[model samples]
Target: MTLEDWGWSPFFAKQFRTWQSRGLIPARVIRGEKNYFRVWSENGELTVRFAGKIRHRADGRADLPVVGDWVAIESQPGRRGLIHALLERKSSFARNLPGRRKGKGRERIEQQVIAANVDLILIVCGLDRDYNLRRIERYLTLVSGSGAEALVVLNKADLCADPQYYQHEVEGIAGKSVVQLCMAKDPEQLDFLFDYLQPGKTLALLGSSGVGKSTILNGLLGEQRQKIGAVSDAVGKGRHTTTHRELFLLPLGGILMDNPGMRELHLWGEEEDLSESFTDIEELAIGCKFSDCAHKSEPGCAVRVSVENGNLSSSRLENYHKLKDELTNLHRRR
Candidate 1:
């Protein structure tokens, strides 16, 4: 397959020109293991590890190459190579990695780039107890500023008698994103998802544990490529079946990255990311008398007025405040 089939485009080609003279080839990182990464170059697929300079040049883990990244590799004789540099990503999503609790307010925070060069993100949410509107908002916020479109895929329709009810709830908070319900085990119901897949495009699946992500991935692939784990009937939660992040090229087209279930999603982004996820609140704040009103107790506060007028839910406003506070605190730490 050509590099275009692997989601390469002019964005990467422009960056690769300088490396071409050095005999370095452009490769797309598909899967990452403990110490190395699996990448597909023009010659063929090869196992590769980044050069020491790559790590030394990186400011943080987010700068390191992750799944779905396009890198310039220095190939060896064998089916292996060394990654000398990471090409600039067209789009990437990251989260705050949990760090040691050094102290109360002095806790260390680090950025963890989950995937790079993605075109779309499937925010999978199960209709069972795994469904939570606030959690979905958090996921949307994480996707904001990543330069990729978001789709809220609510799976396990059979488990919830009123799956549409959950869909409606998600749509209320999903700004500029469409919500779809489906039974992941039933491949027939997943046909609409194919419209989003195409050559030179990449998508990622993100959600908490036990959201039927593996089931959905398998349905799209039309095979059992990734293993699925059982959910605890008592806890109504899912097991961390997918342990690592890997990208798969679809039989038809497009690339899909599967990430491990996240137990906690510590955000790592600017407060502006909230504007996309919390558009409703952001729009309402536009009418506020003050430009920098926090909507807590500010006079002529449009957001708080919406909550009082039943235009917005108080819980949603509270979540907006919570997420805003988290980002503000993160900026302070950084």
Candidate 2:
């Protein structure tokens, strides 16, 4: 497929003008492995690596090219392509890097970009034993600042006795985000997803392992393109079916990215974005007596009153405070 057919648009076309003037070719990263990448350009698929200057200029892992990223490359005959620069991303989904140790007592918070230039983030959740409202809230918080629209996909609906109940509950928590219910094995139930899968758009599937990301992707592709794994009875979790993130071209004309289930989604965003994710709590805080009320022991606190009056779920409030504290700590660590 051509670059445009792979979800490229005027946003990237304009960014590549300067590199084009220098005779560099524009390529979109379809998959990334270690330091090497597989990109789609005018010349078709090519193995590419980051140029030395590009690597030197990158602040950290977040600056590097990822799946769905567009880059300027210099192709060599019978050799690997050199990626000189990464075009500015129209949208990016990232999370705090996991398992980094403090070298000397300095806590450094680093970010890892999940996907670049995605138009929509499919926050997939299984309705079986894996479904949890708190987990969905965490995913929403992680996607709130991602520039892309977040769409919640409640997969495994056939397994749930009352799918509509779960769907409505998620919609209540998701606010402006759209929520859809479907069983990946059932093609008819998956039709609601097509409205957001317009041609030229990119959608990333994200959820915990065994949440049916691979199954959903295969259903959309009308084939077993992604390997599916069976869930274990002991742990009640699905095996890590998808080892890495890969982009696919849908037959109906859209870009789909299937990502490995994220076991931990450490948030990486501004503290203010939390309000956007938790509008219900944010709205309650406005009626608080103190403008800077901590919502803990302050007087005239609408938030605490809501919890006491059974208007707000205590678990939701608890998670909001937990995430807010996490973001505050992340900032200080950085």
Candidate 3:
């Protein structure tokens, strides 16, 4: 397969100029294992590990290679190679990881890079017990800083009495992002997803466990490529069927990455990043009396006023404040 089939474009091509003269070939990381990674290059798929200098030079985890990152590799014997360098990413998404305690009474915050160079992120939510507006808000906020576009996919429409109602609620919160509803069990219901797929683009699935992420992947792939697990009837939650992150090339077009369902997603960027995901509140904040007005208990707060005037949902505002405060606290600690 050519590099374009794996989401390579002029953006990445420009960054790879320096590595071209060298013997190293550019490769996209498809799967990460315990001590090595599986990558695809012009020479075909190869099992590789990064050079020690690559790890020693990395300042943190975000600087290291992750699935979907294009890297410079030197081929070795037996379809094996060494990742000599990690090319710059055109788009990436990360979350705040609670790190070990640093000193007295405090823990450090670290960024965990989820995926790199993704063109789109599918925020999947099930209509069953997995449906949560607040959780969806959190996911959108997490996707805001990533250069990739976000699409809210509400799966399991069969489980919801009126999936359109939830879709509308999501559209209100999605801002410029699109919201789609589908029953992953039926392959036809997923036709809308293909419109966004293109040969040189990469899309990723993000959601909590048991949210039909695998079902959607299987449906789109036209095969049971991923193992599907049953959701617990007692807890109304899905088991961890997918344990790792991996990339797959679609037969029709586009590149898709299926990730292990995330139970908790923490905001990792600056508080200002909220403006993109919470555009409604940010637009209303423009009319606030004070420039530094915090939506809470402030006089002439247009955001809270909208909630009172029925222009915006109280729950959405509450989640905005919750996420804002969480990011503020995280930045303060940093």
lDDT of 1 by residue, 1-334 (tens): 8999999898889999999999999999999999999999998999999899989998988889999999999999889999999888888888898667656654578888887889999999888889888999998998996878899999989999988888888988997899999898898898989899999789899998888888878888989999999998999888898999988888879888888998888888999999999888889999999999999998999999999999999999999999999999999989
RMSD of 3: 1.4
TM-score for each predicted model, relative to the true structure: 0.97, 0.96, 0.97
For candidate 2, give the lDDT of residue 212: 91
Q: Model 1, which residues run further than 4 Å from truth?
A: 101-106
Model 2 segments more than 4 A misplaced: 102-107
lDDT (Cα) of model 3: 0.90
Clashes of each: 1, 0, 0
lDDT of all the models against the reference? Answer: 0.90, 0.89, 0.90
